[model samples]
Target chain A: MTKNKNNILSTENLAIGYAQKKQQKVIASGINFAIKKGTLNAVIGKNGIGKSTLLRTLSKVQKPLEGTLFINKKNSNAYQHLELAKTISLVLTERVPESQLTVFELIALGRQPYTNWIDSLSKKDLQKIQWAITATNLETLQNNRCSELSDGQMQRVLIARALSQDTEIIVLDEPTAHLDMHQTITIFELLKQLTKTTKKTIIISTHEINLATKMCDELIVLSENKIYTGTTAALIQQNAFENLFASKIVKFDRALQQFVIHSQTF
Target chain B: MKQKPYLKHFILLSVLLFIFFLLNISQGSVSIPFKDIFTTLIGNTDVKDSWQTIVLDFRLPKAITAIFVGSGLSICGLLMQTLFRNPLAGPFVLGISSGASLGVALLILGSSVFGGFFLTNSISNWSLAIAASLGAFLVLFAVIMAANQLRNTMSILIVGLMFGSLTGAVIAVLAYFSEATQIQQYLFWSFGSLGNLSWSEMRVFGSIYLVGMFACLSVIKPLNSLLLGENYAKSLGINIKKSRIIVLVITSLLTGVITAFSGPIAFIGLAVPHLAKMLFTTSNHKILIPASAIIGGMVLLICDSIAQLPTSEFTIPINAITSLFGAPIVIWLLLRKKKITI
Candidate 1:
């Protein structure tokens, strides 16, 4: 149960799962982690290891099954939905349901918290949206409908939406899902650049251990028994990732800092 | 955003709506001249008494009713499309019209249940309207309750459809046991109308239409947010439950009130929003709401004009004209675009 003053977001004994028939279906429990400001963090784990659950819980999309979540050293529950929205934003795995929206309009929607009731974008709102479009390198595609864009371009639109929100923390779930290697590496590099340039904290849940270890400043690896949070070098030194796979399929190579097929497989 | 293209389209549509308004009033059974309509529309007594009565008492209200029904149902359709995130959704998708139908069916065909003596001779239009409203609200209430219990918004769409089916089944049962005269009366109600409204009914219909329009305008921000999907909408601080209810209630209110006054007029609500989407090539509800309203009124006015069949005594039912004529035009527009999307 840690709530450090310097951390932008932290958890205290958090438990996460859906409530089925009034019974808590706990997927992960006794979880604890804190993210500092302007840092790029990756929550990496095996399939169904509750990476999305942790991100969703932290973004306040769902209530924690137990314990507390703090945003800026304050109890998260004390913040209003709109207030919290001004502090944190999300890019989720769900596709934009309506495909007819233009790229500019879609990104402009991120200013929902700041726009007036009629949702007309003010000068400041337009500037932020333009900045996000430029940041995501989507200026050429701003006029195109989202349905017309490729998956990689669409992913950037989603990120632009979060960027336009101008929040201190951006949480992305599978930001590179369904994307090619070049696109995945581009997204990872973009996120790193964003955190460095804008001083915004970014947390992403991903299966790309190589990219996580290479690009992210910190890693929150979800294991079955407990959660581990540390710098990649520190976690590697602690051997915190040795049992993450719990499988014989692939082994983590210390020198390469990536997982590779064992030579004995033949 | 530079909305120049649609701004031009709006202006053009507004001008066309005005022409259609005049055209709708002139082409009815009496065939008044455009000058007399202009005169009668303003405070002029120079027109003949017969022309004045036909234009003022008959054609004017019917034309106004056409505009209200068209715009109201179209707005309802727009809201439904955004709410459900399904292009096929329309004003009656939630079955509120069927609820209205069941109410009329129970009143006209439910003689077995309500004792024919009291309601048989004196089923005033007011009572009929009241019954339709009650039936619509009953379904509306049920849908709202169901929406609250269900976490998924798409599930609410299913719940609304289920309510439609449930009420539809009841109406079918009533039609099954009813006499030919009663069934025919209910059938006439279903065919829909625009010319039968009195001034008092217009006042009631117009007020409810305005209220629904205002509520629809109020939800523009949330509606825009909703285009991304619910999770993104929630992240943007939209109260999902509140926005959902407001959308449902406004859609129900507009759809129900229109059905109450004019019967279950179909096709326009479903087709007009698509027309707006096609014309504008944009999904921003800020433009969509008003554009649908204008195009809705224009389409219905045109259809109403065709139904009246200038220089003929026989009149076609508005519903037959709406689908018979409107469908091909929408299909043509879609075909020309070589694509379709909400």
Candidate 2:
């Protein structure tokens, strides 16, 4: 629980959930974790187990039920809205709203928090947008409308948008939700590459536990009414993922080093 | 920046709007020369007295009203569309017009409640605007509340339609209880006209229109961010609740005031934004706002000119011509593009 100066974002005993009808609906609670600089981290859990909730709380999208969140060693609540935006960005799983925006235009919208009143792009913002397009390999699609892109391509566009924000930390919610296997790997690899190249901390809540294990520097596992935060190897050694599911259909296999079907038919 | 081509498109729209302004001003029975119209607009007194009176007092105010109603409603359409992120979102589609209609209907038809004070000529104009705005504001507030409750944008459209029907039912009940002249007064307002605004009314209307338009300008950045979806907009540091309130308030202001002054004109608000989006081929509100405003003004001008063409005893309600001309163009654009994208 020691606060590291290098820790870009950290949470203390965070209770993550939603408020329903003026009552706290605690989906998950008593969670504590910290994310260091320039690391690729993933939050993995069974469906509806509050991985998204925890990520949202950690990113300050939703308020914590009972905890403190710090960014850059400062209480998250102390920073201004735009100041926090410059610190953390998000890649959402929500449907991309219909628009006449081109791939380039869509990504450029990410710089809104940094722009002037009219939202015009500065030279630095323009350069970052270009770099994002090149980084995610969306250069050819820059002129095409976002509506015309395939699901996989749109996911990359979302990442590029987060990149152009130029935040120190980026959080994504199931970026590869609707992609094919190849596209999924491409997204994971792109995320890892982005962290290495830009030195930005990335925390994605994903269902691809195996892919996360293979690519991420750390994993935050939400399961068994407990929160486990550590490197993949360390979590594996500690059996952090044994109770990820209620029915116990899948288990962590030592030989495979990934969650696999323990029974032929469950 | 990929702004050069879009700038050219904006210039082209502006030029077309200017030409249509001349064409519209040159219409009507006396048929003033385009040159005389220009001179009259420039404050030159050399023009004939009759021409000056007709141009300045009648056609000029009507033309300005046409431009205001057209551009104002279309801007409201763009705001609603972006706020809800639904292509079908517009003042009329979302029942904001119905709200205004119900307000005006209540004022005109249900004036018995206020002992016919609402029908007084001297005070009716201001009263009508206030009533329309209040109605538009209430309906808008309800619609926004409903939209906020629902996460799915399409459901917001459905809620808007439901509100439209609800207001229609209320107006019908008011009509059933009213005298014939009251019904006619309400009917006249409902038919929609761009030619009835007086100079005094326009002075007030113009100021309100400018206020709403400037409010629209102030929110362009937030509207641009909203195109990606609200959660992402929030992440981009947009105060979603504040922007939502601003958009809804201006929408109600423009929609209510335009409906009050011009009698609930339709189609311009719904069709012009699509036309602008297609012409500019981008969704940046910075361009779409101006593009839609100009195109809305031009389209309404063309519709107004067409309405004046018969020149006989028979008169065409502007509401009819707008839909007759506008609906087909939107359909053709959708079919030609083979998509219904915003």
Candidate 3:
């Protein structure tokens, strides 16, 4: 078991699942990992391969069927709702508002846990909000309405919201899902800066495995019913990515740093 | 970054409410002196008993009821809009108001069905309140159940509208078979009126509204988190299920109480919240909720005053007046831009 006092999150023999009235469908089992403070990790897998599900489970967005997740070495289930909010922040990959909320106002929502019933912002809150806006390079867009923003700008605004949350850990689902090629690379670079500057654990899910393999400090690969995770160079050495694609048509090329499909003519 | 000028907007709205109150007290059927009205309001009046009756018993309760119902309806609308993530969502859109109308109809027409339940005329009002709350709660419950299965806000809004139309048809059927006098009473209730509330009824309504507003305030954090969508809210340590339940209960209580005391007043719920948002330029419920309440109270005060005018021999229905004030703003909004989908 990998145990560190500074670990922000650690999972033990986790079985992620969806709970209904009478049954639960476990998506994956025997999941184990530890996310240290000041680390950037990317969870990557094929479409419908449960990357999002595992990210959600780790973030406590849903219940785990069996095993336990510990935040700061305490059972995640033990934290009060408000207390949990103060500890971890999350960014979802969905369009949410019809209100003409500006980027600043949307970012201010990250301060909800600290605000009163009226959701007032204090001087410190404003300072933090300004820091987030500046961190995301969204100073000019502070007054612009979220509805008027491009998808790339909206994604940055979302990240700024998480930054304003001031939590030790942030889990985002496909934060770069809708961005263009340039925007995706910029976001990953921003994530790298966030990890080093904020000293916070940042976990995100993405389908851009090649980019993540280059930019992220560590990679979590979900395949079949197992998870393989380690530093990028270490994972490459272990051949963990070789079995990710279909056995018949594709092979992972370690030297060329890409996936190649060999013909079956022979 | 500097926050929006929320305080200035709030103060402006307060001033507007004060002005509207003055206007509301000015335009009754018998035009009392503004001095007398102002004195009476500030509790230094020695006016004649007849004028006092016209001012206090007749006009005061009516005016107060308008403000109370407006506050309740607008807050309810704001909550529904955020909860469903659709600005088009309103009190009636969710079927809560229609549900209350149905309950009032049943109480009026089904007295015989409940003849052995130790009921009396005095108890009928309480019974009506209970029935209205239940009706609203039932619809709210249905919506909550549907939300669990369907995540789309548009689909949930459609379900709510369908529930509204269904309940309206039921009320219409009950009205059809009732006695003519009962039908007239039902029709009057359906058209909406603030003048129907007595001072005693106002106390009951005031208490319910206070409780509902408190419940609404308690969920401000969760509600704000919701502005980012459910999964994000959940990650922020919000219990999405519990928050949704609290919002539903508060919304039902507010809508149910207003509809019970003042009938299913329209347009205020649908329009006032938007007016508040336009004025403030922010969607944070912390400001929007109170802002909407104030604007809603002002609009209803104006509409109720216009409703009391001696136009010919008949006073216009409060609902009609509210529609006149509300529908134009909505039409203007629709014609102006196609950017905001809700």
Best model per TM-score: 1
lDDT of 2 at B166: 97
Model 3 global lDDT (CA atoms, 0 to 1): 0.80
lDDT of 1 by residue, A1-266 (tens): 35456699998889999878878989999877889999999999999989998899999999999999989988999989799899999999987775578899889899999988888778899899999999999989999988889999999999999999999999999999999999999999999999999999999999888889989999998888778889999999988788899877777889888887765658
How much of the true A–B contact set does each candidate keep?
Answer: 0.70, 0.66, 0.63
Off by over 4 Å in 3: A4-7, A247-250, A260-266, B44-46, B111-166, B169-173, B310-312, B337-342
Which of candidates 1 and 2 reaches a greater TM-score? 1
- State the weakest 10-residue window (summed lDDT) of model 3 chain B: B111-120
Task: Provide the overall lDDT of each model, using Cα atoms, as 2-decimal numbers.
Answer: 0.89, 0.85, 0.80
User: TM-score for every candidate vs. truth?
Assistant: 0.97, 0.93, 0.89
lDDT of 3 by residue, A42-135 (tens): 9988888888888788877778899999999999989888888888888777776566677888898888778776678899999999999999
User: In model 2, what lDDT does residue B21 have?
Assistant: 85
Candidate 2, residues A1-266, lDDT tens digits: the string is 53887788888877888887789899887777888899999999988889888878877888888988888888988987788888889998789868778898989988888899988789999999999999999989999988889999999999999999999999999999989999999999999988898899999999888999989999999886788989998998888877778565677877889888767665
Q: Candidate 2's C-alpha lDDT? A: 0.85
Model 2, position A42, has a per-residue lDDT of 94
Docking class of 3: acceptable
Model 2 chain B poorest 10 in a row by lDDT: B114-123
